[model samples]
Target: MKRCKRVAVVLPVAAGLCLVYAPVAVADADASIVSAEVSGTLTPGARASVKVVVMNHKAPAGQKSCISAKMDGGGGTSCFDLGAPGTSVTHDGFMEVLKDAKPGPRTVTVNLLPRAVGGLGKDTKTVTATVGNAPPACDPVSLNRDAFQLGHTEGLKDGREDGFADSYRQSYDDAFKKKPGLTAEQCQDFALSAFQNGYGKGYETGFKEGQAKGGKVGEKEGKEDRQKGNTSRNVTIRQLRVTALPATGEADCAQGVKFTASFLGSGTGTIQFHWERSSGKVPGTIEFSGGDAEPKTVTDQAAVPAGATTATLTQKFVIDSGPSKGKTAQATANVTCKK
Candidate 1:
């Protein structure tokens, strides 16, 4: 392009980008696009070279013909001097798809631009190129690991306590046969490869069995200890006190006998108080809860039967937590009733 300058920049595919540039004066004209052809392949994670061929309705010698090709949205342009009316030019450029490009057909466009003084035309044509999947890299260690995982899964699926060992061994042996020389420094199998793979398999099997057995034994021991109340920390119920105001009362016993229950202890727990009228056939009993600590008190009115002469209230406070959980302290108070 003598009159109009164009710079074609072919960016390296390694950078995941490709560029083609052709800068020309913009104008609308009437010219026939003889032919516009684009050919390329879409490759995942690699650059693809595209060949663009364009033939136009000819222009003067000083006119310019620019061919541009775009692949998956990346485009580049190249310009050539129009020799005759049947002028044609081929543009070579590259385009890149994403490393994780999906396997499908990608759109590629080829544009033809004729720079003519009298009047020219802009033409574009689009075609599809299939992007192929990337080739798999060779990795022996990964294969081995995959085999090991499969074996473990098989063992679990078999529902046998010791099945994992045999299953893992079999899978590992099969993998070893396929990739005998495969080794990874970080892999546990690397050192085991020196010996028969079976030995390593057996060791793993036994280790798993031992672990299961040890877990069962530990669980059983823990259960037995719990049943025996063999706790590392034990809380003891040290004292219990009960008091009744107006220990001797008459028919006024119905007036409300105040019974106070106090418990003293050194632990964190709830103290349950069970109060009952044991002496007289009092109909109702009071049950309340208090904190397990020094000077924790609970008070409730003692129910006195209509004809009862005395109300003997018996009470007990039980610890509901701590090492001394379930231990109890007992106290009693007497309320005499007289008409």
Candidate 2:
């Protein structure tokens, strides 16, 4: 940590980062950190804090220690991660970063890391200011948001007809700045908590972890015989539709898609909201304005839009009078189909 051009900041459970950035020294380290609370956006007042952790590599087994400091990146030496070694002392609410002033790349003072925990008396070469921050990557947001909090709730399976999985990974990870030196087991659970809040009732995103794929023993013979004799029919009970047009300028971690749906034709007799899965299909839902309505009302409905693959959507309504009386109505929720 002392007299170094490139300091490696090793994060436990994961390798450290290379603090091969810039460094700036200041006459008063503590005063500068207290004065440099970078902030932005408070349509929502921004809350900020500084963590100063000091470490003594050569200190004796049972003696107290001293600390020094520095900053870098912006013209001011007000940026850093830790100041105290055995403990992380933090300071908050000193200054505010302008909402309009774009945040430039931020770097920590590596040399300052050791100096913060002041060197031994008369030991000028013990530890000096270096450049870089801990955990390597600076996640300002994780500091602000809970690891369990759902940030950009787009495509939550609980809220959608089909559970959206793959899309939520990054945002979930972003919410939790996992603790330093976290274990592998801890990491797995850490990842789970990030998306836990997203799996609210009515929407279960994860799979049933322990149940077997095969049927249970001591099954009823009547049901087994009926199942062997009966035919399996596909039913498209509900559909999904979205209204937003292909949006331009999606956020850094989003891919916005938009579309609309309709149940233009009617089932001359009975009608019902539906759900179904085909040989190869994604689960979807029927549009509901909170109450049961006719198919025309189903027209121009808002849903998650047609996905990349195609599926046949059969509207299961009865038409009693026609030669196909009592037969279900069939339609395709296809992109090329007429609205």
Candidate 3:
């Protein structure tokens, strides 16, 4: 007897949806099979039935046709001859679970191969059914008070172990059913090792979640601390000055203007001074001494061109380091020429 080939089958979980896999038809006008389904207790040696609706684009109703169906890993192919455009045709493709079938989910595949000139291409569908073993019978038991309390604790432990084992077993079974590549022993080992390390699995999950939350909290706290420190240091700009001096020949002959910036703060840091002029001269930057209590000053000079009537100098002072970083002040001076 020829044994059926085992293949992966992905079934739809939605109600009234069939797991159909149909290739492009070779026929001029394609025919199709839809709503193919399997129904039966998947227990070992149980009877089962498969049904589908056959449709043909060119064939009229009442036309006789042949179709075939087969399981994924069990009995051989079964064929049926039925009328065209049939509804719920239970063709000769009835199914039966083997006596040695294991207790787990099994894939049942049905292929609709019709024999017609320029027939519709092969249409295949699959479904999953759970094959179960006979459940063990419960035995009567009587326990004293201490035994009852101990039993309660043991029951909780047993429950968790059983759940863990079952979860791994189900996962392995699903993998096998989808691709029967793993031996039974391999599948069992996978489940057993996973169940044995349940605590490690739980710790890994918890650790990642805790680390992410801690990282966010730590980042927020660090920003707040920096702000508090900067506020406490209290950095300030004390004064700014601009002076213009002309040559001896003319009071307003014009030469250059001097810019100064002074800083005052309790925080020890570097102060950056930026100088600008209304005469469209190139701007310049300079550094000044900065620290607690004592004032620090920096200066820059901008040349005045011949046609320039007035000189406007602007200075911006910024604390560039320590807790007082980002604090800034500005000053401007205007010098008029005598005509």
lDDT of 3 by residue, 97-195 (tens): 676777766666656665656544355556565655632322112112223334334334434333332232333333323432344344444433433
Candidates ranked by TM-score, best first? 1, 3, 2
How far residue 67's Cα lies from its native spot in candidate 2, in Å, is 6.1
Better of 1 and 3 by lDDT: 1
Tell me the whole-model lDDT of each prediction, alpha carbons only. 0.46, 0.27, 0.44
Off by over 4 Å in 2: 1-18, 21-58, 65-69, 72-107, 110-198, 202-339
Candidate 3 whole-model C-alpha lDDT, 0 to 1:
0.44
Candidate 2 lDDT score at position 57: 32
Residue 259, candidate 2: C-alpha displacement in angstroms: 52
Weakest lDDT window of 10 consecutive positions for candidate 1: 1-10
* Per-residue lDDT of model 2, residues 1-339, tens digit only: 001011122223322222232223432223222222222211111212222333323334223323332232222223323323232223231222232333334432322322235533211111112222222232434521333344114213223322211222222222222311354345445544544433342133222110111111102221332345422111112223323232221111122223233433222222233322232323233322322233443332223334522222332233222111123343333222111
| Candidate topping lDDT | 1
